[model samples]
Target: MASSSAATRELQKELEGKANDLSKIQKDISKNHQVRKKYTIQLGENELVLKELDLLSEDANVYKLIGPVLVKQDLAEANANVRKRIEYISAELKRLDSTLQDMEEKQNSKKEAIYKLQQRIQSLQAGKAKA
Candidate 1:
Protein backbone atom coordinates (compact mmCIF):
# COMPACT_ATOMS: atom_id res chain seq x y z
CA MET A 1 0.00 0.00 0.00
CA ALA A 2 2.48 2.63 1.23
CA SER A 3 5.20 0.91 -0.82
CA SER A 4 5.85 3.90 -2.99
CA SER A 5 9.05 5.73 -2.00
CA ALA A 6 7.28 9.02 -2.61
CA ALA A 7 5.03 8.41 0.37
CA THR A 8 8.07 8.08 2.64
CA ARG A 9 8.76 11.80 2.33
CA GLU A 10 5.19 12.51 3.25
CA LEU A 11 5.34 10.03 6.14
CA GLN A 12 8.52 11.56 7.49
CA LYS A 13 6.96 14.97 7.30
CA GLU A 14 3.77 13.78 9.00
CA LEU A 15 5.55 11.74 11.70
CA GLU A 16 7.65 14.64 12.92
CA GLY A 17 5.34 15.82 15.77
CA LYS A 18 3.34 12.62 16.46
CA ALA A 19 6.15 11.11 18.57
CA ASN A 20 3.87 10.35 21.56
CA ASP A 21 2.14 7.52 19.66
CA LEU A 22 5.41 6.53 17.92
CA SER A 23 8.04 6.00 20.57
CA LYS A 24 10.46 4.13 18.31
CA ILE A 25 10.66 6.96 15.81
CA GLN A 26 13.85 8.26 17.39
CA LYS A 27 15.61 4.96 16.90
CA ASP A 28 14.41 4.71 13.34
CA ILE A 29 15.85 8.12 12.62
CA SER A 30 19.22 7.06 14.04
CA LYS A 31 19.42 3.59 12.44
CA ASN A 32 17.77 4.27 9.11
CA HIS A 33 18.89 7.81 8.46
CA GLN A 34 22.38 6.77 7.37
CA VAL A 35 21.26 4.34 4.65
CA ARG A 36 18.29 6.47 3.73
CA LYS A 37 19.31 6.57 0.08
CA LYS A 38 19.76 2.80 -0.18
CA TYR A 39 16.35 2.20 1.35
CA THR A 40 14.45 5.25 0.22
CA ILE A 41 13.68 6.93 -3.06
CA GLN A 42 11.41 9.52 -4.68
CA LEU A 43 8.33 8.23 -6.43
CA GLY A 44 7.33 11.37 -8.33
CA GLU A 45 7.27 14.01 -5.59
CA ASN A 46 6.90 11.54 -2.66
CA GLU A 47 9.99 9.99 -1.03
CA LEU A 48 9.71 6.73 0.93
CA VAL A 49 11.72 3.70 2.07
CA LEU A 50 10.77 0.33 3.43
CA LYS A 51 12.29 0.20 6.90
CA GLU A 52 12.74 -2.86 9.10
CA LEU A 53 12.81 -1.06 12.50
CA ASP A 54 15.04 -3.80 13.78
CA LEU A 55 16.61 -6.22 11.35
CA LEU A 56 18.03 -8.30 14.17
CA SER A 57 14.83 -8.49 16.24
CA GLU A 58 12.10 -7.39 13.80
CA ASP A 59 10.26 -6.00 16.80
CA ALA A 60 9.87 -3.18 14.41
CA ASN A 61 7.63 -0.33 13.47
CA VAL A 62 7.08 -0.14 9.72
CA TYR A 63 7.84 3.50 9.07
CA LYS A 64 8.20 3.73 5.33
CA LEU A 65 7.30 1.22 2.63
CA ILE A 66 10.53 0.38 0.82
CA GLY A 67 10.17 -2.06 -2.10
CA PRO A 68 7.76 -4.80 -0.89
CA VAL A 69 9.73 -6.65 1.71
CA LEU A 70 9.35 -7.01 5.49
CA VAL A 71 12.58 -7.87 7.23
CA LYS A 72 12.06 -10.29 10.10
CA GLN A 73 14.84 -11.68 12.29
CA ASP A 74 15.74 -14.23 14.95
CA LEU A 75 15.86 -12.35 18.25
CA ALA A 76 16.65 -15.51 20.18
CA GLU A 77 20.02 -15.79 18.47
CA ALA A 78 21.01 -12.25 19.39
CA ASN A 79 19.93 -12.77 22.98
CA ALA A 80 21.99 -15.96 23.15
CA ASN A 81 25.08 -14.14 21.98
CA VAL A 82 24.67 -11.51 24.73
CA ARG A 83 24.19 -14.20 27.37
CA LYS A 84 27.36 -16.01 26.32
CA ARG A 85 29.46 -12.87 26.63
CA ILE A 86 28.11 -12.15 30.09
CA GLU A 87 28.83 -15.69 31.31
CA TYR A 88 32.39 -15.56 30.01
CA ILE A 89 33.14 -12.28 31.76
CA SER A 90 31.61 -13.48 35.02
CA ALA A 91 33.73 -16.65 35.02
CA GLU A 92 36.89 -14.67 34.39
CA LEU A 93 36.17 -12.39 37.37
CA LYS A 94 35.61 -15.36 39.65
CA ARG A 95 38.92 -16.91 38.61
CA LEU A 96 40.79 -13.70 39.39
CA ASP A 97 39.21 -13.49 42.84
CA SER A 98 40.36 -17.01 43.71
CA THR A 99 43.91 -16.28 42.62
CA LEU A 100 44.04 -13.15 44.77
CA GLN A 101 42.81 -15.07 47.79
CA ASP A 102 45.52 -17.72 47.39
CA MET A 103 48.23 -15.08 47.14
CA GLU A 104 46.98 -13.34 50.29
CA GLU A 105 47.10 -16.59 52.31
CA LYS A 106 50.66 -17.27 51.20
CA GLN A 107 51.82 -13.77 52.23
CA ASN A 108 50.17 -14.11 55.65
CA SER A 109 51.93 -17.39 56.34
CA LYS A 110 55.36 -15.98 55.42
CA LYS A 111 54.96 -13.05 57.83
CA GLU A 112 53.92 -15.34 60.67
CA ALA A 113 56.91 -17.67 60.18
CA ILE A 114 59.37 -14.73 60.25
CA TYR A 115 57.91 -13.45 63.53
CA LYS A 116 58.17 -16.87 65.21
CA LEU A 117 61.81 -17.33 64.17
CA GLN A 118 62.74 -13.91 65.55
CA GLN A 119 61.24 -14.83 68.96
CA ARG A 120 63.29 -18.06 69.10
CA ILE A 121 66.55 -16.20 68.35
CA GLN A 122 65.83 -13.58 71.08
CA SER A 123 65.40 -16.29 73.79
CA LEU A 124 68.67 -17.99 72.82
CA GLN A 125 70.58 -14.65 73.03
CA ALA A 126 69.25 -13.99 76.60
CA GLY A 127 70.50 -17.45 77.81
CA LYS A 128 73.99 -16.85 76.31
CA ALA A 129 74.15 -13.52 78.15
CA LYS A 130 73.47 -15.26 81.48
CA ALA A 131 76.34 -17.69 80.75
Candidate 2:
Protein backbone atom coordinates (compact mmCIF):
# COMPACT_ATOMS: atom_id res chain seq x y z
CA MET A 1 0.00 0.00 0.00
CA ALA A 2 1.16 3.53 -0.67
CA SER A 3 1.90 5.88 2.21
CA SER A 4 -1.16 8.05 2.61
CA SER A 5 0.79 11.09 3.83
CA ALA A 6 3.21 10.83 0.95
CA ALA A 7 0.37 10.51 -1.53
CA THR A 8 -1.42 13.49 -0.05
CA ARG A 9 1.74 15.59 -0.07
CA GLU A 10 2.43 14.66 -3.68
CA LEU A 11 -1.09 15.52 -4.69
CA GLN A 12 -0.83 18.86 -2.91
CA LYS A 13 2.38 19.63 -4.73
CA GLU A 14 0.79 18.79 -8.05
CA LEU A 15 -2.18 21.01 -7.26
CA GLU A 16 0.11 23.85 -6.26
CA GLY A 17 2.04 23.54 -9.49
CA LYS A 18 -1.16 23.57 -11.50
CA ALA A 19 -2.38 26.64 -9.61
CA ASN A 20 0.88 28.42 -10.38
CA ASP A 21 0.53 27.58 -14.04
CA LEU A 22 -3.04 28.86 -14.00
CA SER A 23 -1.82 32.10 -12.44
CA LYS A 24 0.72 32.53 -15.19
CA ILE A 25 -1.93 31.92 -17.84
CA GLN A 26 -4.18 34.50 -16.21
CA LYS A 27 -1.34 37.02 -16.24
CA ASP A 28 -0.71 36.33 -19.90
CA ILE A 29 -4.38 36.86 -20.66
CA SER A 30 -4.26 40.19 -18.83
CA LYS A 31 -1.26 41.27 -20.85
CA ASN A 32 -2.97 40.28 -24.07
CA HIS A 33 -6.11 42.17 -23.09
CA GLN A 34 -4.05 45.29 -22.39
CA VAL A 35 -2.37 44.98 -25.74
CA ARG A 36 -5.75 44.63 -27.44
CA LYS A 37 -7.02 47.68 -25.60
CA LYS A 38 -4.02 49.72 -26.66
CA TYR A 39 -4.60 48.87 -30.30
CA THR A 40 -8.30 49.66 -29.97
CA ILE A 41 -7.46 53.11 -28.61
CA GLN A 42 -5.06 53.69 -31.46
CA LEU A 43 -7.73 52.67 -33.96
CA GLY A 44 -10.18 55.06 -32.35
CA GLU A 45 -7.67 57.88 -32.49
CA ASN A 46 -7.04 57.22 -36.17
CA GLU A 47 -10.74 57.31 -36.87
CA LEU A 48 -11.02 60.58 -34.96
CA VAL A 49 -8.21 62.03 -36.95
CA LEU A 50 -10.01 61.07 -40.15
CA LYS A 51 -13.17 62.75 -38.86
CA GLU A 52 -11.27 65.94 -38.00
CA LEU A 53 -9.68 65.98 -41.42
CA ASP A 54 -13.10 65.61 -43.04
CA LEU A 55 -14.38 68.54 -40.99
CA LEU A 56 -11.35 70.62 -41.88
CA SER A 57 -12.04 70.06 -45.58
CA GLU A 58 -15.37 71.89 -45.15
CA ASP A 59 -13.63 75.00 -43.78
CA ALA A 60 -12.09 77.27 -46.43
CA ASN A 61 -9.61 78.87 -44.01
CA VAL A 62 -8.37 75.49 -42.80
CA TYR A 63 -8.00 74.18 -46.35
CA LYS A 64 -6.03 77.31 -47.29
CA LEU A 65 -3.71 76.87 -44.27
CA ILE A 66 -3.14 73.23 -45.22
CA GLY A 67 -2.86 74.22 -48.91
CA PRO A 68 -4.05 71.89 -51.66
CA VAL A 69 -3.54 68.49 -50.10
CA LEU A 70 -1.54 66.22 -52.39
CA VAL A 71 -1.63 63.30 -49.98
CA LYS A 72 -4.54 61.38 -51.46
CA GLN A 73 -3.35 58.17 -49.83
CA ASP A 74 -3.75 59.43 -46.24
CA LEU A 75 -7.38 58.33 -45.96
CA ALA A 76 -6.74 54.95 -47.51
CA GLU A 77 -3.69 54.35 -45.35
CA ALA A 78 -5.55 55.40 -42.20
CA ASN A 79 -8.37 53.00 -43.04
CA ALA A 80 -5.93 50.19 -43.71
CA ASN A 81 -4.06 50.89 -40.50
CA VAL A 82 -7.31 50.84 -38.48
CA ARG A 83 -8.35 47.61 -40.19
CA LYS A 84 -5.02 46.03 -39.35
CA ARG A 85 -5.29 47.14 -35.71
CA ILE A 86 -8.78 45.61 -35.45
CA GLU A 87 -7.57 42.35 -36.90
CA TYR A 88 -4.65 42.22 -34.50
CA ILE A 89 -6.91 42.92 -31.53
CA SER A 90 -9.34 40.23 -32.62
CA ALA A 91 -6.57 37.68 -33.03
CA GLU A 92 -5.06 38.48 -29.66
CA LEU A 93 -8.44 38.24 -27.93
CA LYS A 94 -9.07 34.91 -29.60
CA ARG A 95 -5.69 33.62 -28.48
CA LEU A 96 -6.29 34.72 -24.90
CA ASP A 97 -9.73 33.13 -24.84
CA SER A 98 -8.32 29.85 -26.07
CA THR A 99 -5.51 30.00 -23.56
CA LEU A 100 -7.97 30.63 -20.72
CA GLN A 101 -10.11 27.71 -21.89
CA ASP A 102 -7.11 25.41 -21.99
CA MET A 103 -6.01 26.50 -18.53
CA GLU A 104 -9.51 25.95 -17.16
CA GLU A 105 -9.53 22.43 -18.61
CA LYS A 106 -6.14 21.72 -17.08
CA GLN A 107 -7.30 23.03 -13.69
CA ASN A 108 -10.40 20.86 -13.87
CA SER A 109 -8.33 17.79 -14.69
CA LYS A 110 -6.09 18.42 -11.72
CA LYS A 111 -9.09 18.83 -9.43
CA GLU A 112 -10.47 15.54 -10.72
CA ALA A 113 -7.18 13.86 -9.96
CA ILE A 114 -7.22 15.26 -6.43
CA TYR A 115 -10.80 14.04 -5.96
CA LYS A 116 -9.84 10.54 -7.11
CA LEU A 117 -6.90 10.51 -4.76
CA GLN A 118 -9.19 11.46 -1.89
CA GLN A 119 -11.59 8.68 -2.78
CA ARG A 120 -8.79 6.16 -2.99
CA ILE A 121 -7.42 7.21 0.40
CA GLN A 122 -10.88 6.86 1.91
CA SER A 123 -11.25 3.41 0.43
CA LEU A 124 -7.84 2.38 1.76
CA GLN A 125 -8.75 3.51 5.26
CA ALA A 126 -12.06 1.70 5.11
CA GLY A 127 -10.36 -1.50 4.03
CA LYS A 128 -7.80 -1.23 6.80
CA ALA A 129 -10.57 -0.77 9.35
CA LYS A 130 -12.41 -3.81 8.02
CA ALA A 131 -9.29 -5.99 8.25
Candidate 3:
Protein backbone atom coordinates (compact mmCIF):
# COMPACT_ATOMS: atom_id res chain seq x y z
CA MET A 1 0.00 0.00 0.00
CA ALA A 2 2.85 2.41 0.79
CA SER A 3 4.49 1.59 -2.54
CA SER A 4 1.23 2.18 -4.32
CA SER A 5 0.77 5.50 -2.54
CA ALA A 6 4.27 6.55 -3.50
CA ALA A 7 3.64 5.69 -7.10
CA THR A 8 0.39 7.63 -7.08
CA ARG A 9 2.11 10.65 -5.57
CA GLU A 10 4.82 10.54 -8.20
CA LEU A 11 2.27 10.32 -10.98
CA GLN A 12 0.31 13.22 -9.50
CA LYS A 13 3.46 15.35 -9.35
CA GLU A 14 4.28 14.54 -12.93
CA LEU A 15 0.77 15.43 -13.99
CA GLU A 16 1.02 18.78 -12.22
CA GLY A 17 4.28 19.55 -13.97
CA LYS A 18 2.80 18.69 -17.34
CA ALA A 19 -0.24 20.82 -16.58
CA ASN A 20 2.03 23.79 -15.85
CA ASP A 21 3.94 23.27 -19.07
CA LEU A 22 0.68 23.08 -21.03
CA SER A 23 -0.53 26.29 -19.45
CA LYS A 24 2.69 28.09 -20.34
CA ILE A 25 2.48 26.83 -23.91
CA GLN A 26 -1.11 28.04 -24.16
CA LYS A 27 -0.08 31.49 -22.95
CA ASP A 28 2.73 31.60 -25.48
CA ILE A 29 0.29 30.63 -28.22
CA SER A 30 -2.05 33.41 -27.19
CA LYS A 31 0.79 35.95 -27.23
CA ASN A 32 1.88 34.72 -30.64
CA HIS A 33 -1.68 35.14 -31.94
CA GLN A 34 -1.78 38.71 -30.67
CA VAL A 35 1.56 39.59 -32.25
CA ARG A 36 0.48 38.01 -35.51
CA LYS A 37 -2.73 40.05 -35.46
CA LYS A 38 -0.84 43.29 -34.95
CA TYR A 39 1.53 42.44 -37.81
CA THR A 40 -1.40 41.61 -40.10
CA ILE A 41 -2.97 44.97 -39.34
CA GLN A 42 0.31 46.70 -40.10
CA LEU A 43 0.63 44.80 -43.37
CA GLY A 44 -2.85 45.88 -44.44
CA GLU A 45 -2.19 49.50 -43.56
CA ASN A 46 1.12 49.46 -45.44
CA GLU A 47 -0.56 47.96 -48.51
CA LEU A 48 -3.18 50.69 -48.43
CA VAL A 49 -0.46 53.33 -48.18
CA LEU A 50 1.31 51.76 -51.14
CA LYS A 51 -1.90 51.78 -53.16
CA GLU A 52 -2.54 55.45 -52.36
CA LEU A 53 1.04 56.30 -53.29
CA ASP A 54 0.57 54.54 -56.61
CA LEU A 55 -2.51 56.65 -57.34
CA LEU A 56 -0.68 59.90 -56.67
CA SER A 57 1.07 61.88 -59.45
CA GLU A 58 4.84 61.59 -59.72
CA ASP A 59 5.34 65.13 -58.39
CA ALA A 60 2.74 64.83 -55.61
CA ASN A 61 3.96 66.03 -52.24
CA VAL A 62 4.47 63.25 -49.66
CA TYR A 63 4.97 63.77 -45.97
CA LYS A 64 5.80 61.27 -43.30
CA LEU A 65 4.35 61.69 -39.84
CA ILE A 66 7.22 61.82 -37.43
CA GLY A 67 6.13 62.16 -33.80
CA PRO A 68 3.34 64.64 -34.50
CA VAL A 69 5.40 66.41 -37.16
CA LEU A 70 4.91 65.98 -40.90
CA VAL A 71 8.27 65.79 -42.57
CA LYS A 72 8.38 66.26 -46.33
CA GLN A 73 9.40 63.15 -48.24
CA ASP A 74 9.79 62.32 -51.92
CA LEU A 75 6.97 60.30 -53.44
CA ALA A 76 9.35 57.67 -54.75
CA GLU A 77 11.00 57.35 -51.37
CA ALA A 78 7.63 56.96 -49.67
CA ASN A 79 6.62 54.24 -52.11
CA ALA A 80 9.83 52.36 -51.59
CA ASN A 81 9.56 52.58 -47.81
CA VAL A 82 5.98 51.36 -47.82
CA ARG A 83 6.84 48.50 -50.14
CA LYS A 84 9.75 47.47 -47.96
CA ARG A 85 7.56 47.59 -44.85
CA ILE A 86 4.96 45.41 -46.55
CA GLU A 87 7.57 42.89 -47.55
CA TYR A 88 8.99 42.78 -44.02
CA ILE A 89 5.56 42.38 -42.45
CA SER A 90 4.63 39.63 -44.89
CA ALA A 91 7.80 37.74 -44.10
CA GLU A 92 7.25 38.14 -40.38
CA LEU A 93 3.71 36.86 -40.78
CA LYS A 94 5.00 33.78 -42.53
CA ARG A 95 7.50 33.16 -39.80
CA LEU A 96 4.84 33.67 -37.16
CA ASP A 97 2.58 31.24 -39.00
CA SER A 98 5.26 28.61 -38.93
CA THR A 99 5.89 29.19 -35.22
CA LEU A 100 2.17 29.07 -34.48
CA GLN A 101 1.87 25.77 -36.26
CA ASP A 102 4.69 24.32 -34.22
CA MET A 103 3.21 25.62 -30.96
CA GLU A 104 -0.20 24.20 -31.79
CA GLU A 105 1.35 20.84 -32.51
CA LYS A 106 3.18 20.94 -29.18
CA GLN A 107 -0.02 21.96 -27.43
CA ASN A 108 -1.90 19.04 -28.93
CA SER A 109 0.73 16.57 -27.87
CA LYS A 110 0.78 18.01 -24.36
CA LYS A 111 -3.00 17.70 -24.15
CA GLU A 112 -2.76 14.06 -25.20
CA ALA A 113 -0.07 13.45 -22.62
CA ILE A 114 -2.14 15.08 -19.90
CA TYR A 115 -5.14 13.00 -20.84
CA LYS A 116 -3.07 9.84 -20.67
CA LEU A 117 -1.71 10.87 -17.29
CA GLN A 118 -5.23 11.40 -15.95
CA GLN A 119 -6.23 8.00 -17.18
CA ARG A 120 -3.19 6.47 -15.56
CA ILE A 121 -3.97 8.15 -12.24
CA GLN A 122 -7.54 6.92 -12.40
CA SER A 123 -6.45 3.40 -13.14
CA LEU A 124 -3.94 3.44 -10.36
CA GLN A 125 -6.49 4.65 -7.90
CA ALA A 126 -8.95 2.03 -9.08
CA GLY A 127 -6.32 -0.66 -8.66
CA LYS A 128 -5.47 0.57 -5.18
CA ALA A 129 -9.13 0.48 -4.23
CA LYS A 130 -9.44 -3.08 -5.48
CA ALA A 131 -6.35 -4.18 -3.63
Candidate 4:
Protein backbone atom coordinates (compact mmCIF):
# COMPACT_ATOMS: atom_id res chain seq x y z
CA MET A 1 0.00 0.00 0.00
CA ALA A 2 2.89 2.38 0.82
CA SER A 3 4.53 1.53 -2.50
CA SER A 4 1.31 2.26 -4.32
CA SER A 5 1.01 5.63 -2.57
CA ALA A 6 4.59 6.48 -3.52
CA ALA A 7 3.87 5.67 -7.14
CA THR A 8 0.82 7.90 -7.06
CA ARG A 9 2.86 10.77 -5.64
CA GLU A 10 5.47 10.34 -8.32
CA LEU A 11 2.85 10.39 -11.05
CA GLN A 12 1.25 13.51 -9.59
CA LYS A 13 4.60 15.28 -9.50
CA GLU A 14 5.25 14.39 -13.12
CA LEU A 15 1.83 15.61 -14.12
CA GLU A 16 2.40 18.93 -12.37
CA GLY A 17 5.71 19.36 -14.20
CA LYS A 18 4.10 18.63 -17.56
CA ALA A 19 1.26 21.07 -16.79
CA ASN A 20 3.75 23.83 -16.08
CA ASP A 21 5.59 23.16 -19.31
CA LEU A 22 2.33 23.26 -21.23
CA SER A 23 1.41 26.60 -19.67
CA LYS A 24 4.75 28.08 -20.70
CA ILE A 25 4.29 26.81 -24.23
CA GLN A 26 0.85 28.43 -24.40
CA LYS A 27 2.24 31.77 -23.23
CA ASP A 28 4.98 31.65 -25.85
CA ILE A 29 2.39 30.94 -28.54
CA SER A 30 0.34 33.93 -27.40
CA LYS A 31 3.37 36.23 -27.52
CA ASN A 32 4.25 35.05 -30.99
CA HIS A 33 0.71 35.75 -32.16
CA GLN A 34 0.86 39.32 -30.86
CA VAL A 35 4.18 39.96 -32.55
CA ARG A 36 2.89 38.50 -35.79
CA LYS A 37 -0.12 40.80 -35.66
CA LYS A 38 2.08 43.85 -35.22
CA TYR A 39 4.24 42.78 -38.14
CA THR A 40 1.19 42.23 -40.35
CA ILE A 41 -0.05 45.73 -39.58
CA GLN A 42 3.34 47.18 -40.44
CA LEU A 43 3.38 45.26 -43.73
CA GLY A 44 0.00 46.65 -44.70
CA GLU A 45 0.99 50.24 -43.88
CA ASN A 46 4.22 49.88 -45.85
CA GLU A 47 2.32 48.56 -48.86
CA LEU A 48 0.03 51.56 -48.70
CA VAL A 49 3.03 53.89 -48.58
CA LEU A 50 4.52 52.13 -51.58
CA LYS A 51 1.29 52.58 -53.53
CA GLU A 52 1.17 56.26 -52.72
CA LEU A 53 4.80 56.65 -53.75
CA ASP A 54 4.07 54.95 -57.06
CA LEU A 55 1.28 57.45 -57.73
CA LEU A 56 3.54 60.42 -57.16
CA SER A 57 5.17 62.19 -60.14
CA GLU A 58 8.87 61.59 -60.68
CA ASP A 59 9.81 65.14 -59.69
CA ALA A 60 7.38 65.39 -56.75
CA ASN A 61 8.84 66.18 -53.33
CA VAL A 62 9.17 63.39 -50.78
CA TYR A 63 9.83 63.85 -47.07
CA LYS A 64 10.72 61.34 -44.35
CA LEU A 65 9.63 61.96 -40.76
CA ILE A 66 12.68 61.64 -38.55
CA GLY A 67 11.76 62.30 -34.91
CA PRO A 68 10.14 65.74 -35.01
CA VAL A 69 11.54 66.76 -38.39
CA LEU A 70 10.35 66.00 -41.90
CA VAL A 71 13.61 65.62 -43.83
CA LYS A 72 13.54 65.77 -47.61
CA GLN A 73 14.17 62.43 -49.34
CA ASP A 74 14.51 61.34 -52.96
CA LEU A 75 11.38 59.68 -54.38
CA ALA A 76 13.30 56.63 -55.66
CA GLU A 77 15.04 56.09 -52.33
CA ALA A 78 11.75 56.24 -50.42
CA ASN A 79 10.20 53.75 -52.81
CA ALA A 80 13.12 51.36 -52.43
CA ASN A 81 13.03 51.57 -48.62
CA VAL A 82 9.31 50.87 -48.45
CA ARG A 83 9.66 47.89 -50.80
CA LYS A 84 12.52 46.47 -48.75
CA ARG A 85 10.53 46.92 -45.52
CA ILE A 86 7.57 45.05 -47.05
CA GLU A 87 9.84 42.19 -48.10
CA TYR A 88 11.37 41.92 -44.63
CA ILE A 89 7.97 41.96 -42.91
CA SER A 90 6.68 39.25 -45.25
CA ALA A 91 9.67 37.05 -44.49
CA GLU A 92 9.26 37.55 -40.76
CA LEU A 93 5.56 36.63 -41.04
CA LYS A 94 6.54 33.39 -42.78
CA ARG A 95 9.02 32.56 -40.05
CA LEU A 96 6.42 33.28 -37.35
CA ASP A 97 3.91 31.03 -39.13
CA SER A 98 6.35 28.12 -39.10
CA THR A 99 7.18 28.70 -35.45
CA LEU A 100 3.47 28.93 -34.52
CA GLN A 101 2.85 25.59 -36.24
CA ASP A 102 5.66 23.94 -34.30
CA MET A 103 4.40 25.35 -31.00
CA GLU A 104 0.85 24.17 -31.69
CA GLU A 105 2.17 20.67 -32.44
CA LYS A 106 4.05 20.65 -29.17
CA GLN A 107 1.01 21.90 -27.30
CA ASN A 108 -1.16 19.13 -28.76
CA SER A 109 1.35 16.46 -27.81
CA LYS A 110 1.56 17.76 -24.29
CA LYS A 111 -2.23 17.70 -24.02
CA GLU A 112 -2.24 14.07 -25.16
CA ALA A 113 0.41 13.17 -22.62
CA ILE A 114 -1.55 14.81 -19.85
CA TYR A 115 -4.68 12.99 -20.90
CA LYS A 116 -2.86 9.65 -20.82
CA LEU A 117 -1.40 10.40 -17.43
CA GLN A 118 -4.84 11.20 -16.02
CA GLN A 119 -6.12 7.92 -17.37
CA ARG A 120 -3.24 6.07 -15.76
CA ILE A 121 -3.91 7.68 -12.39
CA GLN A 122 -7.58 6.84 -12.64
CA SER A 123 -6.83 3.20 -13.45
CA LEU A 124 -4.39 2.95 -10.58
CA GLN A 125 -7.01 4.35 -8.20
CA ALA A 126 -9.65 1.96 -9.54
CA GLY A 127 -7.31 -1.01 -9.04
CA LYS A 128 -6.52 0.10 -5.51
CA ALA A 129 -10.22 0.38 -4.76
CA LYS A 130 -10.84 -3.16 -6.05
CA ALA A 131 -7.98 -4.55 -4.05
What order do you get sorting by TM-score, best first?
3, 4, 2, 1
Candidate 2 stretches greater than 4 Å from native: 56-131
> Residue 94, candidate 4: how far off, in angstroms?
0.3
Q: List the candidates ranked by lDDT, beginning with the highest.
A: 3, 4, 2, 1
**lDDT per residue, candidate 3, 22-92, as tens digits?**
99999999999999999999999998999999999999999999999999999999999999999999999
Clashes of 3: 0
lDDT of 3 at 125: 97
Cα-based TM-score, every candidate: 0.36, 0.51, 0.97, 0.96
lDDT of candidate 1 over 35-61, digit per residue (tens): 333322222112111122123345633
User: What's the CA RMSD of model 2 in angstroms?
Assistant: 6.7
Off by over 4 Å in 4: none
Backbone clashes for every candidate come to 7, 0, 0, 0
Worst lDDT 10-window in candidate 4: 1-10
Candidate 4 clash pair list: none
lDDT of 2 by residue, 49-127 (tens): 5566555543233211136553334544544555676567667667766876776677667667656766766676676
**After superposition, which runs of candidate 1 have C-alpha atoms over 4 Å from their true positions?**
1-79
